[model samples]
Target: MVQINFAQKQVNAKIVYYGPGMSGKTTNLEVIHQRAPEPNRGDLTSISTDGDRTLFFDFMPLDLGTVAGMRTCFQVYTVPGQVYYNSTRKLVLQGVDGVIFVADSSPDMMEENLESLRNLQENLSEYGRSSEEIPLVIQYNKRDIPGALPIEVLEEKLNQRGAPAFEAIANTGQGVFPTLKALAAAVLDSLHKSSGSSVPASAPAAQPVAAPQAATAQPSAPAPAAAPAPQRQTISMSQTGFHKAPSLPLQGAAAPSEAQAPDKGARPPQNAATTPGPQALGGLQLKGGSEGDGGGLRMAQPATPPAPEQPPTQPSLSMAVPPQPPAAAPAPTQAPPATATATAKPQTPPANRPATPGSMMRPDGGSPPPRRAPASKSFPSKVQEAHATPKGGKPKSAALTVLIVVASIGLGAALGSFVLQIL
Candidate 1:
């Protein structure tokens, strides 16, 4: 996958170097790490076993300068090449954007090269990818070795799709950069071609050209020349499915000049009425005049209704009446003088007042009621109390003595019976 980072303004891609074991895959990465410019490369990391065989992979990040305003970064990896390490090799192929097959060109390693290429195709198939779709380059490595096979034989066996090929002695850094550069360029070009297809078909392709023109025209101020520039620019952007830029104020001013040639004052009212467009500049209102009214321009003001009139009333001599002290309320009819009739004698206690123990009245006319006893314990609590024994009491020696006597009597009766049977 090729990843585009809009926030960081960067484009990232993955490229893996794959081939048979000891085919100079690791060597190619080491040469690149050592020779690439300090600023353009990152740390070279390798995971390998004691024999220096790449156990997993080697990683090196290469930064190529900006392309179409985005920084380009290619993360390069070299997968372990041993047959038993196919699992790690498959994992390293994940999300690969490009491939560089480092074929060992010595005559002895031809079979290994073919096996590795077939393995590459199988691993890519698992990811629903095909080697034909991804950008690929081949490096015929170990070419400087004696008895190395000819380049034609290597290509026939490996470069079946006519991918770019380089004869490389990776140990001495020969052809390393050319191989890398070819793959990187292919990856970027593929990304560019792919990005083009994502654009909407309805979009106008020429809009980008107008953007540069607008940016260049920013310093000019002549109304006539500046007027058409923005109009053309807006139309181009609008056609391209881009948000239309705001119409320049100068463009509006140009309209008035063009309209001035045709009886400027009379034209405004006619245009205002007939067009029914937006209001005039500077908040001015244009209203058509009626026939009887002299057709002259007038400053308009809001209309207000006239207030109503009221009839006057005659002045009265007592309009201001003097406040009179509230009339004193009639004396509350002396409450009819409370009567002195004698009160009835106090009633005597009832003759049949019950004589209950606590109900007896004292001579002083009041007695306190007797307190009741507390309620008994619950059933469960009484059972628990009955089973509880005194903690300090001695163990039951009498029960142990009775058990011993019963056992001795049973044993003696058994012995006497056995003796009678023997006699």
Candidate 2:
């Protein structure tokens, strides 16, 4: 287990010393601890069973000088080497970052050395680690023995990954530091590669090296121009089948719009419907004023009155015309017996007059169409008569109407008499 303590600027790793029983594993740790500077090493701890085997393991903390500004510490452990203590070995091997296999150099102990090596492999496999990747060093300990096996022979037999090997007499500390240093360096190298860090984690400046690249980045391109405002629909008298004028020209030969100019002084009529909206035509959006009102325009019918019997003969005349333009005091244009009567003898309707079709307009050079008093009776007056009690209860309205009629007749008669006198 290799842990980088970012908070303390320390790097801690576990180093396990593994070997067969009586193979001098503990001796190597003791030598390292004793030789390590007092300021750099922690207390050594050892626990053993009655059979002279390590009951648990030996633990010591060996601290080293700052490497790349990080305090380096190694937790050294030596597992019990007897075959019967295999469980303790596996437990001790957990999270081991590096392993030092101290093999006995005695020829008689070769089988025991091989057995311990196999034990190490099994323990590492149990933790899902491969000996090939872990930082490992081999020490042929008891090298001072006279009958020690040759280094070449030991290498051929027990060097699992061609790991670095050293001959060490653990009690005297011969080659001990070299083996330890090599394994420590290897473990640190692995840590650096895995972290993708050029310096140790203790160095805070590693992250700031990327600042220049960020500063060199170009400013974002100007945001795209705002989308153009959507096209707006416009209303026109021609399109709504309506006009603002009091009356169309008597010449009806020309369209009302072409005949009469707009009245600048006139305000929009209170009764004017809101501008017609463009309805979806098969999901197609049409341009404003593209459609004429005549497509659906018709005279608004009185709610209570029955629809009039349409003249079967004059189908063209019977079809209703669009609503008339509103006027403050409109002068009704009477249909002459010339244009309309020539086409059909259709009976005129009573009540609110229907729209006058333009076809009823007289030709040019013709006198203005005559106005009729009876045709001028307002529909509301008829409604008044129907609803009012007739026995003088509503006499004021009737008398007012009669007075207006008499005055109009008298004026006409006087004008005739005056014309006679002039003649």
Identify the leading candidate in terms of lDDT. Answer: 1
The residue pairs that clash in candidate 2, if any, are 1-95
Clashing pairs in 1: none
Off by over 4 Å in 1: 194-423
Model 2 residue runs over 4 Å out of place are: 50-52, 194-423
State the lDDT of candidate 2 residue by residue for 27-103, as single tens digits.
Answer: 66755654565677765555543222455787778888686689989999888888987987899989999888888
The lDDT per prediction is 0.51, 0.50
Worst 10 residues of 2 by lDDT: 280-289
As a whole number from 0 to 100, the lDDT of residue 236 in candidate 1 is 17
lDDT of 1 by residue, 30-122 (tens): 556545666777755555542345667878788877866999899999998989999999999999998998888778889999999999999
